[model samples]
Target: MAITFSDLHTEKGIKSLDQFLSGKTYISGDQLTKDDVNVYAAVVEKPGDSFPNAAKWYHAVTSRLAPSFPGNAQGVRFGGKAEAAPAKAAATADDDDDLDLFGDETEEDKKAAEEREAAKKSTKKKESGKSSVLLDVKPWDDETDMKKLEEAVRSVEMPGLLWGACKLVPVGYGIKKLQIMMTIVDDLVSVDTLIEERLTVEPCNEYIQSCDIVAFNKI
Candidate 1:
């Protein structure tokens, strides 16, 4: 029998999903489909570690839907409480026959196909791993030359490092800190190594007193 979850925002619904996803990769079958996307969109946040199965499923679906995950968290209503069971079967049947023999597809089918292709490309790209970072480059004092400091920070380069937009923000006194953005390939760059070995030492250190990561996000 197929399981149907309701009130997906509640603990009871999440637990049901967790149990359903145990030893499974996708919500319905072996491959990702609109069902996964719909259920994933319904849940408000990543499942905590307490729900190990659900949490794992969440992250797997997340990586699979990268760059195009839904922004909204509105709970999806499958059907009225009375029609839940049939709705699951109907949805599954629809997914199975999205494309007809003539190769004609509904607009919704086309969009879903496009999103699936995009997800595939994103998954492949993620194999190399990458992250976007924002760093706060501090100066020793207000007298520090902000222009030269920025130049020095940008000077240090590596195989995976690409510098991006930057701006200075007032600290308290006349001192201003440089907020810089950078993208790095995870395999080729280590933020800790960059700070401990490069930015906080030698030539770059002349203008940079210390460096702290303001934000780090996977791309």
Candidate 2:
């Protein structure tokens, strides 16, 4: 019978029990029986909302059967009441007490935390101070002056400029551009001066037409 009723799988069939159980307290005769348990389990396996009769009967039976159990049935709510505010507050206090078992931080631990945070901020500041620049270096004619171009790029020796990769790229129309990637210190004024000196100096200036910064970005 349980399998047969469950296999019905129809809304009307499942809700049919609502009227049947309206005047009765149990699914079989008037008292609880194996038939009631079997029917309740079958109904719960179906959609809870579509089988309102089944959901109500399942809850009614389970509550009476396991009222004192530590846990409630999954997906089945009871009484529709939340925990009282005082009880929730008490639970929070208990959680705090449990966490307090670890004790307070020592002075050394506090000092170490401060030192770590300070070091982190200092590192971030140093990184933010550094910047990258892309320079477009062109020669006078179709001829390429690799040595002069490289010499010019390295001529400006400054503490702020940390030259990384220097390469000559050949662009269209017989012009080769010099791409220079470097890291500079926080002093932007010194960096600008160094770049100005590199482009205006002899060997580099003789072979180069015009030098301009194409792109710039912070690290």
Candidate 3:
């Protein structure tokens, strides 16, 4: 349940983690695409399987909740500093209403919304925040750095609570191979393994490093 100094440094990885203890998007990077978030759910929520188009999210979700030893970044300690991993896979699709993707109604949420609206109208302040992903900056956009980044991916930890945080399942994708790659990223333990299994060659380390699996700590 211990969030390292690194995770806290990023705004997108763990949104207001100290102030908001639970909810999806609370800790994972803001740059995460819809697929990234969904894959996160499959890995932790439905570990041992990969649903299409959700790999990066799988990595982000698992790192925050991977079953780990105390003080380590693996295994999520849910319902406390970290939420506990659910004991069972959902019994049916109809149970969606029970999922708690965001935190419940609280005085803080109400006050914060009011304050934000007041600030916007009174000052008309337009804070300049950037989107999570900037296609222009992606290393893969440059072949040279991509190699180096994948190496970094191998060393990072992904947790499992991502499953609890989401409920995404892809029906299809706009691009074929890209969707396939997305599938590869969906398996927490096997994103890298699947690459090796299919390609019979190691993928670039940058593929790993460029990975946006890192998440915000919510405990």
Candidate 4:
């Protein structure tokens, strides 16, 4: 199958594009690494099984479109995985102190083995402790609404402007009125600039519903 401006033929695609620009949807069941997400995105947008072609396109477009270095902005994060110090070697002072230093049963070699195991365990903890993203929304309403929204933010313990806003739009509009104005709360890579670009289009909808989504550093 072939794809083009006309080939993106889903009802969601049409309606979304009309209501928002760059009507692209990146859908996934579980979380994915930045690279994995991009690759996944390319594959999904492709017409058929030409995933390799999709990969190439994804890489090429991302190379130009994405702000940060490869796999930085959008990727899985595991805290303290790298540069983690190994655990202290098992103290063998309690064990037989008379063991030889060089023999297979020697204390010195046993210590080395224990050290390696400790290092592996430490590394695993660092790799698995990465956090997941939590998305929250704030809508544009009257003065009372803003107060309510602020209270909601406080209840969630999220900070100000650090999160984004998005709307579940039903109208087929994109790139025009910019229904979502994802204001930046942090000096994050590409977010500020990307948000500006996304707003280049109009945000118009006959029946539009909107909410704001921002990224809050999950404490």
TM-score of each: 0.44, 0.38, 0.18, 0.21
Candidate lDDT scores, in order, read 0.76, 0.57, 0.32, 0.31
Q: Which of 2 and 3 is ahead in TM-score?
A: 2
Tell me the tens digit of each residue's lDDT in model 1 across 1-219.
123568877888889899999998878767666566657756766778878998888777665544232431122223422222322322433334452322346676688788989999888767888899999999999999999999999999999999999999999988999999999999899999999999999998889999999999999
For residues 39-136, could you state the per-residue lDDT of candidate 2 as single tens digits? 54445333366556566665665544343333644322235422222222222332422422124665655887899899999888676566787777
What local lDDT score does residue 63 receive in model 2, on the 0 to 100 scale? 46
Error of 4 at 199 (Å): 28
User: Candidate 3, residue 88: CA error in Å?
Assistant: 11
Worst 10 residues of 2 by lDDT: 82-91
Count clashing pairs, candidate 3: 44
Q: What is the lDDT of residue 73 in candidate 2?
A: 40
| Candidate 3 lDDT, 1-219, residue by residue in tens | 112222432443333333332334423435333233232232222222232222233345444433432343332334333332322221111233343233365565588788878988766434322121111112333233432443333333343211122111222342111111121112233443433442223444334223222232222
C-alpha positional error of residue 103 in candidate 1 after TM-score superposition, expressed in Å: 44
| Sort by lDDT, top down from the best | 1, 2, 3, 4
Model 2 local distance difference test score:
0.57
Which numbered prediction scores highest in TM-score against the true structure? 1
Clashing pairs in 2: none
